[model samples]
Target: MIAAAALIAAAPAVLALDGTPGQGAALTGSVPPGTTLQLDGQPVAVAADGRFLIAFDRDAGPAATLLATLPDGQRIVRPLSVAPRAWRIERLPTLPRISQPSAEFRRRRAPELAQIEAARDMATDAQGWRQRFVWPVRGRISGLFGSQRIYAGEPGAYHSGVDVARPTGTPVAAPADGVVILAAAAPFTLEGNLLMIDHGMGLNSAFLHLSRIDVKPGDQVRQGQVVGAIGATGRATGPHLHWGMKWHDARIDPLLLAGPMTP
Candidate 1:
């Protein structure tokens, strides 16, 4: 639990400039017509309905602000109050040692990286995916976004996306309308059979460990559209879908971006 003094100290009196969160709570709000919103110095899109939202990184420390600019140039700042969360930390003693990839693996991974980079460089033509997002797949959540991980008994990177555990060949759908930026078959060291979509304005989603890709690059897809099938392709112990979302270079939590997942 967060200390009462911390919450009180973090909370602001009025909308003055940028608003910050308490500790772990996310910062979210709306803006006026024709105006933009920024949270933690990242630009957020304001929908036609005047709704806008931004999320803090799960590891985000205390002391951040949310800023909204009115159409008439009026600025509103509000401090955020975030509640602390108890995290589960595990240290494995017999983790497998990761060796350098073979030359063949390196040769196969290069093109895949190039393709993904090209997709990330796509231009934002319109605000098509700013609307509410639909679930790409329905299943039990096997992994959560922002959870610290120690893979194969070694200290590994933090989990950057949500993982859905489903049977192999389960259909994977688009979470929102977007252009298919990457569709290719490659050997990924971690994420296997990956596909990425661009949702405009530096927002993107990636589907990993897929069995089949139904969409192609440059194709326009709608929310709930079946884009691929799930599988255990790359480095995996079982069949699962690894869904990741990003804002420009920042790896925002996909679950935060889309809210809670449905069963």
Candidate 2:
């Protein structure tokens, strides 16, 4: 096993890695060109230039393995120590019921879920994950990723994305380059005027509770391009942008990509 380094010879090695190394963090790195890599037994997409990305889940354990096969048929396995995170826990005696959904709503869920799953399964040539992310809208952060909420002493769903509280009509921009995969011109039962973008290699971004969408499916958008506007169009209490990200089925933290909004 070799330690991660910024630059290494054309051998089985880790060239560069960035991110917290904790759950919900997207680990972006590189290896020698033409080398094959895998994360926890799953084949990772390595671009022609050897750049790769792997994101940890919210409940991911404290360790992961990175295996690389060199051009010379040699193999190297690096056991990575993933740091544990302290998630925010909110316990409330009384809260809106999120645990139960109507049967009709549940019936409609299958198609929506399938669409989202199919969108994230896409592996495109656009290298959007290598770019620096920008905030879709500058607003007060109302919620964070991986934060759990308990209602009446029962644990409920953890927040899957960051919530930015901005007034309706606030422009929401694309954080990176991508092709618009799902642009719901009509409101979704749960996500409202939903819009989703595929950033290649099984990584995707979803913008929920949108009031208006500026892009359509198949439209290629660049960094900082406006995709929609903030709104309380779904089950939200007030107007806000719910920015979520996923790498395949593993949900990742978007703030980890965009960082804190400029004060």
Which ranges in model 1 have alpha carbons more than 4 Å from their true place? 1-28, 45-51, 82-84, 94-97, 103-111, 125-129, 150-154, 185-187, 257-263
Q: How far out, in Å, is residue 109 in model 1?
A: 3.6
Q: lDDT by residue for model 2 over 1-263, one digit each (tens)? A: 34455223433345567655888888788877897888888898888888888888888899987787766756666667888889999888877556578889989878877877776666667678888878878879999999998888888878999999988999999999999989886777878889999888788899999989999888899999888899888778999999999988788899888877788
Q: Candidate 2: where is the Cα deviation over 4 Å?
A: 1-15, 93-99
**lDDT tens per residue, model 1, 189-258:** 6678889988876678999989889998889888888999999998888999999887666666566556
* Alpha-carbon deviation at 176 in model 2, angstroms: 0.7
Using Cα atoms with residue i matched to residue i, what is each candidate's TM-score against the true structure? 0.75, 0.91
Q: Give the TM-score comparing model 2 with the true structure, all chains together.
A: 0.91
Winning model by TM-score: 2
Lowest summed lDDT across 10 adjacent residues in model 2 is found at 6-15
> Which number leads on lDDT?
2
